[model samples]
Target: MKKKIYIYILVCTFVFRIISPAYISASTVYYDEYVTVSYVSDISGTSFPSTKTSYLWEGEHMVYKFQLSEPTIIKAYFSWSQSDEVPGGIAWFSKDMYGVDIIGNTAAISSKNKYNLILLEPGTYYINYSFGKRGSYKNAYNIGLSIAGQKVNTNTLVSASSWENPNVIRTDFYYEGFLSNLQPSAHYLFSVSSKSYVTIDYLFKQVDNLKADSAKCTLYYRNGRVIKSQKYDTRDTSKNKIAVLLEPGDYYINLSDATAPTSLYVIAEPRTNTLTQSIKRYTNKDVTVWLDSSYDHERALMVSSKVTDSNIRSNTVWKTSRNDTCLVIEEDFFTVSENGWYTVRTEDENENYVMTTINITNIDKVPPTTNIVNNKTYTSKSITIRFDDDVSGVKSAKLNGKVINYGKVVKAKGKYKLVITDQAGNAKTVVFTKK
Candidate 1:
């Protein structure tokens, strides 16, 4: 019997050794990972009510500490029971050194609170948790911890800013998922991608309720590098629209309106360019063209038809419904002088401008060359355009102010022809002489 007892004790010891603890390791953290919110407590019972305990509230804020070895990109996410009552909000973060919020509202989860952390350097960080500006904090909330890409069982904590008498943690009660910080009529999310340009689209509201008075947007890059800005006023609540020019890299965008409305939604898409900028063509006659302009100003084009006001006719041969980086300059017949100068004026909406001048006598004075070979007929409404050479800065072709797809039939004639423009706004059009 004593021998049997000894063998049983040995077996118990082996079982204990094989089973690991519920909590994972203490050290050995990886880079670029995601963490979620795990534990939450409402101390004040005001903003974070017990009724919303099991589910995450949009107003509840939490903080967490983590160590980093090197600069890393951290993407954060959240897991919770999806409930019908919770409205969505934004997530934010701050470095551990300073208490200031360096990156404000980096990501917004209007429908889902999941977010990606803004890029951070190697060191310790204490993330700021809030449901936006909607409600106040009533108690303490906890966020889940993950390092180097592994989720571990560790304690997350939230405390009042001060522990003195009348120590208030701003803990308040709230319904599940209510984004208290999001303004009813002015709420928006601004995302500036690696390539500085910003794209904003509406979200989370009816089509008509979202409208802006000025349609003006601004972007901040490399810690306050201001770029180009523009203004527009329209009721078109479409999918996505580009805002303005910015330097290439990460940035922040802000959209605002003078007149307040109801609910507003906005998002930013990364700036991308598939074409390069260059000079497209030069008129044999005297004419100067403005190439590309920096984000701060508008490119200009000046033409000296040298025709009398009575004889010279002016028209917008080509204008883009969508903004184009490169365009071609085109004008109808203009009598030129042997030693006269034709100029193109490039000016932005802001009234900033530049000018380019060409001397008429310089070139072998000749009109833009063309070829009518392998002539194709228009079965459907279409027009054909042939270029002399691979024109510089003529990245795209447009007809009647609308961008035309390459190899697609353009259904227009005469004044409505294939117009090309350079980045400098030097433009040209190949008028279709109807057969």
Candidate 2:
């Protein structure tokens, strides 16, 4: 009887050793390093949220880390497959591995889903999850986590200056994660090197029974002062926009109170100096008028008889070219059929004027006249000749096809040929004999 009992005890001890190793290995299947949880869209229906998942078996655990740049209210979600027999799982938020729980532990029970809304400050945090040893069979458990609130740190910087292209920044604001009780907001930062005109354009899309009145945007100074603010309704389209002139400084823009996702575009255009000058040109030809400034599609060249007169024609070709290093010139072509003084002006959307005067006249066609007559006898030792041009003045005079000073005295000893030409390329010739 003692020998039989000894054999049974040895067999039981061997079985216990084998089973203990498997239990230790299963309990130690935890992640040594924490996985970072970044925001990712996993939205459905009217909820705009991001989700991250981790898997664990019975008696195993996992940890995830996330950082917040600003104070935000976030929703934490822990869920698993509904088909599997309900496994006992618990999750909690903490500042570190050994820190006390910021939000008390939440259990995943027969419901298969658990969520909590907690406001967190700007800092790094960790979420720890564990599957307790309740079920005898090993089963995989999926844990889902998410956060939602003001995403102010995700800002786009805008530089609005003449040298750079018009700055346009765009973004989409949506409710993040699975939390529907809290709305999402976005923030943007921009700087104007000088005074500029800024336009804010946005499109609001209703999410599952949400109205447009739930959306709004505000512009603020760097010092937290409000500059301009507007709300949107169902009728608010991209065409409905806000325009404001901002001084040289940094500014902030915020969009909030949105029940649905919204798309927004902010355009900042720098102010330009007006160019005022005059040009004298001949009619029946095309003349190019240019200014050293940036190009804008909204600016158009306008033509009229007087500065104050209503514009008669605005059909002019405008083009932009670079003439020197960092110098841009905007040029417009103007043509006239008759002679007159026409005002050519261009105005930006902000009503800033750039204007010039064009004095047009017909080309000189009449030739110069002279006192010398053809086949006339002149016996004097020296003769004085005079030249006159009515329209364009006399350009030059020639004697015997050789250019000479005009109004100069000449010797009248033999047959002489004289020629005169005007500034308009008109010429006249005369032949005379001296006896």
Candidate 3:
């Protein structure tokens, strides 16, 4: 019996050694990789209360970290497939280092899939998720993570900044913003080529009854002119939608709080129509395209800076039809390679081709190159910067990383370090001290 006990102990030790602390080394992925999500915490109580598979807590925030060796492009995006509740908040880096939120409520997986392809110098980066203004923190639903080493700009409606606060919004998708003590206002920008209806779902989740004027949201024009306003109260539990009928043009959304912070989600639903193809094209500085909508068997012609209107082949189609062909641009819409003169050709079932000329006027996507005209002529007050190429507009001009107001400094100055970012999102940082 003593001998048998010793043998049993030996067997137990062997089993423990084989199974103890298994470690999987990080693999070097050269190509793209759909990153599977593993739940770090089990959902219970308010820690995370939702039917969704993935989620994040408000204050602690869910940190999803991924690592890849060797320098490559990192394409990050999330999908809330078939879920009733989407993230009512923000999805950016763990800390706001990028100065831009990767995704937000109004700009999640709306009508199209959107991904931000950033080239990170090989290391581990955490993609953080959390709820923002509204009280929708405890639970978020249907979050998917996608990653790749190449550019994946396939989303149509990307989130943009609000006028009053930093809340991001997508004209085509939906977003939840807030008006609280710290941030008393929320803003969004939308445009329509023709008449369309707008909807704002204000979530009224309050403990006690409040006065009428305590909370309000107003729709306005791009230039800060009010179009209309609506009021809500704490007693209201239903998502009382404030709908507006407006003519074709540009507009903005402004949500404010009279007493306390309130949560509201913004969505723009274009009136549905049978696309029997006498195609009506619509666009603005920021445009939304429902190209992801099911339209197989039907064909669309694409005309841009490279292609002319005369170029039309029956086999031609919209780049958006293919998940990989679309390119994400200013308004988060899948459009041609560049913003310039372009045309789209749509065909009816009757084999008729209707074409629309679209002139995409916007800032230059190219980075500006700087050159000092004269080395002999220089002063502290003035420094002449001649760009290699004329840009649509200079977003910001700086000398030695200091704020140099345009027209304030002349063509005379000390050593020059000129850094400029044009309209197209490209940036150039040149450090040459007025040599």
Give per-model TM-scores: 0.22, 0.39, 0.25
- lDDT: worst 10-residue window of model 3: 1-10
Ranking by lDDT: 2, 3, 1
Lowest-lDDT window of 10 residues in candidate 2? 1-10
lDDT of 1 by residue, 138-256 (tens): 32233332222212111112111111211111111111110111211122213343433334432222212223445554444535555534343454545324455333344443344
Which of the numbered candidates is closest to the native, going by highest TM-score? 2
On the 0 to 100 scale, the lDDT of residue 388 in model 1 is 39
A best-first ranking of the candidates according to their TM-score comes to 2, 3, 1
In order, candidate lDDTs are: 0.34, 0.52, 0.43
Report the CA-based lDDT of candidate 1 relative to the real structure.
0.34
* lDDT of the structure predicted as candidate 2: 0.52
Supply every candidate's count of residue pairs whose N, Cα or C atoms clash at under 3 angstroms: 51, 3, 16
Q: For candidate 3, lDDT tens digit of each residue in 139-171?
A: 434455554342112121222225754344545
- Measured with C-alpha atoms, the lDDT of residue 27 in candidate 2 is 34
Our tally of clashes for model 1 stands at: 51
